[model samples]
Target: MPAVAPTLPDDLREDPRYYLRHFQFVLDWVAAHHDSLLAESEWKFIVGFGELPEVSQALLVRMVSRKGELFRLSRLDYAEIGDSDRALVPLVEAGMVIRDPLIGLDELFAQLRVPELRQCFAERLAAHGIAKSATRQRLLDVIQEYEEAGDAEPQRRRLSHWWTETTDQLVQLTVMPVCDRLRLMFFGNLHQTWSDFVLAELGLVRYQQVDLGELSHAFQCRGDVDLYLALHDLRGRLDEGESIEALLTEIPPPAQDNPWLAERRARLLYRLGQQAQRDGDIPLALHCYGLAGPGEARIRRLRLLERQGEYAEAHRLALEAQASPCGEAEQQGLERLLPRLARKLELPRPELPPTRQPRARVLELPADHLVICGSVELAVRDAISHSDRPAWYVENGLITGLFGLLCWEVVFAPLPGAFFHPFQHGPADLRRDDFVARRRRLFDTALARLDDGSYRDVILDHRQRCAGLANPFVHWELLEPELLSLALDCIPAMDLRCMFQRLLLDPAVNRSGLPDLVQFLPGERPSYRLIEVKAPGDRLQDNQRRWLDWLGRHHISVEVWHVEWRHD
Candidate 1:
């Protein structure tokens, strides 16, 4: 009956046994909290993951702070499952607790109530913030490499130094999720060896439930947040390549001013000069090609001039390049930009779309969906709702994505972009709290896959059918048609940026066929629902009216609800 004051081993910083014991504690706690864990509120986050006196407290602090992933993903080899077949046995057992191809909505929901004694581990993902990032993947790769390596240092496992390296990787990459650092250092299985937690965290065993082909769609259509994260990660990869290039500049490859690089550099300079000339910086352009030394850069310049209505000079340069040496990538470069050159020569510049809008506001239907003829925010908010979360929180607090758990989702509609204004910046009701945290646990438990390694079929099938509306860059919202049941009878937000030459790139749907975000609620059913949202105080317009008329057709039958937000 006394309070449990947790303490950890002094040498746990180096010992795997410490982590093994720690995981046993978390698994046991969740199993016992059965009712409280199940009956948790939407806004609060409860941490009782591990057993070590220090680990349990540390997990609490970690979950409260920013570095939450370690709490969720950190686990041991499931030695507590009677440690008979340490590696493969635990996996086999976890496979039974959670299903295979674990990414789909159904499988996730199904796994919701796996009996706790059988439940090995879970991070109790918070909807308010993001999960781990690519940095985790990278660090995981590093640890995996070292662990699988042949020259196994005998002391590495018993000492904490190696754990320090992995933890350091997490910190360096800033991929520590929304948790704390000090807590991770002392408690939790993160400091332990590869176990059930690691497999689940890395999407290896957890992914066994998801067929690669099945996830192609969820991966493609998970929602705006994931897509944005993807873009940032992709760009990060590119930036890394650039960083390496910069390092090359500073160190100068041991090739030490090699002739090949010199020739390559000269050609690049020549191309820069040519580009300058086309932009009417004639002198600068010529200067660039002046010291070219018969590189590709010089040859390309003459060709550029010819395409830019400077035929006479272009002809002369072509003659100069008669004996110029050309490099590989640059040799075909002139031909690439040639079409743009020809068009300019053939006609005056094409007229750009007018910046004016036919209207200024958006439309709100009886059912909370926003019909926008002009406002960009309405479209943004709607897309976000449809894509990732079916609904976000309005009352339970920060644990919700945007609409919270009120969505009656049958489809995946991705937001136009990956990034949204942080919910923390908006309101406290949707802020991280116990209720939302509990809902996520519920959602995860309910949606867990059923098979050990059978996710391939379910996910692949769902993705093939996902008509969620995402764009050239796949964020996690549902595009129209992504849903078979959640048929949104709504209108596309106006193409405000006019990035597409034809702003109405997709054909206009007839009023009879207009999609409403709420129209498809079956028999007026989706266990939970959310109202449509629009930018604050948007005024409706004719086109929006038309779109509404289409949605109105089904508004009554769906029986959904409302809660819209506008800036004004």
Candidate 2:
């Protein structure tokens, strides 16, 4: 089913308390649908929140919607909720927020301006013989230096204790952690937030209204939710430059039953391996790569072993990988590595299949032509384009856009765990291995339009109706009507079906590395050719080479244009 268009009640815009209502709607939706996922404390929070006054509720929502937990009472001015102090009373009493909470010196520095910091730490600064006019960082450094020299423990105190003369009060929201869990349950991920609702409501963004059935939820059980959160936290720690060894110990073992969680685990381990390599810990890197489940991990291990002169092990792994490659990239890597590894081990050279080379041409243009056109690709495009054929520097956008349009329904199908909320730009399992397998029937039905000569109509209709909606594959700005119409006319449906099939083989990898420009010739029996432009001294990237080879094998017209600048 197509997503329902976004509609709002007539009075929704007029109401000043619309955000409060939106927040309430999310809570109610989660409670009604995902009540089993909520914990005892979370259930109590929902019940207690409803009992609070409207002002307190509105104030709390406003705080929750913002970035951080701590907010200065004076700065939180809202016309919808009058007198924040009065509203805060109910929140503080309900234990949703903490008034005058103990905070560390680092946090105190973050909250205060230079002037405020100087005033607050005047005694400490003067005792250390520091100047009042010093920069905030300088003051902080001096104070920290003196404190460290004296071996003083870090200080934690209330706002009043830190700044005796200041009248402004600070309150820390205690409910954001629980609210985040609720948000995760509603969105199925932490990336989307409350702003998605606000954006959709204000007409700033639109979404497909997927028909989420009774069984439509992100988590099958509480354990899945807990595991997802734990993985997310570990990823955060890795990003924050945490100790690799410590973080490795904390990461949960791969979830064998759940490919989604397993993929996440593999990605984290892969990233950890990369970090270990950067740190120059070869042994640790090898261990991480060995344990990093599937995907690029095997290739990394092969490369590391090769680099360390462990040719025997590298050759063995290469042969193993050649037998069962993860994807095209990994397969390509093995093709190159195996030949070299065999030579290193003094073994008989393995006979590999001959490589296909795409048609290549060299163009000599005036050096200043680059200055006029701004890039080599554009210059090449302008030079080759004529009345019979025109080229656009589309790179990966055109073909992917066509795929997105043709498969819109299949992509947005509300499968179990595919979509948990209205704001998702695409399905949750879009890049997973089973993405196509799980929705094979829907995909087959949609692709059937191509065979019946209805794909052009279907794609054109979607372009007209769903122009501005977000899609992972489609680039709305690049898919102008003229270009789209031209592509539909010039590119054969059979060719499109072939390209779409390759894309489905590996959506995450194959979506990239398309030729830089696509030149279309429109007429009776219209045709198009894909072109990859390279400047002086530039070479084809691994992904680009793979794409060129694949396209040529499928009998799709593709070329490499190498541009040279004229010395004169």
TM-score list, all predictions: 0.21, 0.94
Report the poorest 10 consecutive residues by lDDT, candidate 2: 1-10
Residue-wise lDDT of candidate 2 within 120-229, one digit each (tens)? 88888888788878997897898678667776687788999989999999999999989988888888889988888778777777787788877788777778778889
Give the alpha carbon lDDT tens digit for every residue of 1-568 in model 1. 1134223233343443444444444333332322221223210122322222443333222323332222212332232232212322222232211212212222222222233201211222222132333233333344344445645542222112222222211111122331212122112212322243344333333211111121121111213222233333433443444332222223222123233234434544554565556567766666667555554555555655654567556544544443342432232333333344446456343333222222223444333233452333344335445443443322111111111111112111122111111110111112112213323443333233322322233333444442232212112243223342232212111111111111112211111122123322233333323233334444433333333333333232211223344443
Error of 2 at 508 (Å): 2.7
What's the C-alpha lDDT at position 254 in model 2?
A: 62
Candidate 1's clash total is 99
Q: Provide the RMSD of all predictions against the true structure, rounded to 1 decimal.
A: 23.6, 3.0
- Candidate 2, residue 363: how far the Cα is off, in Å: 2.9
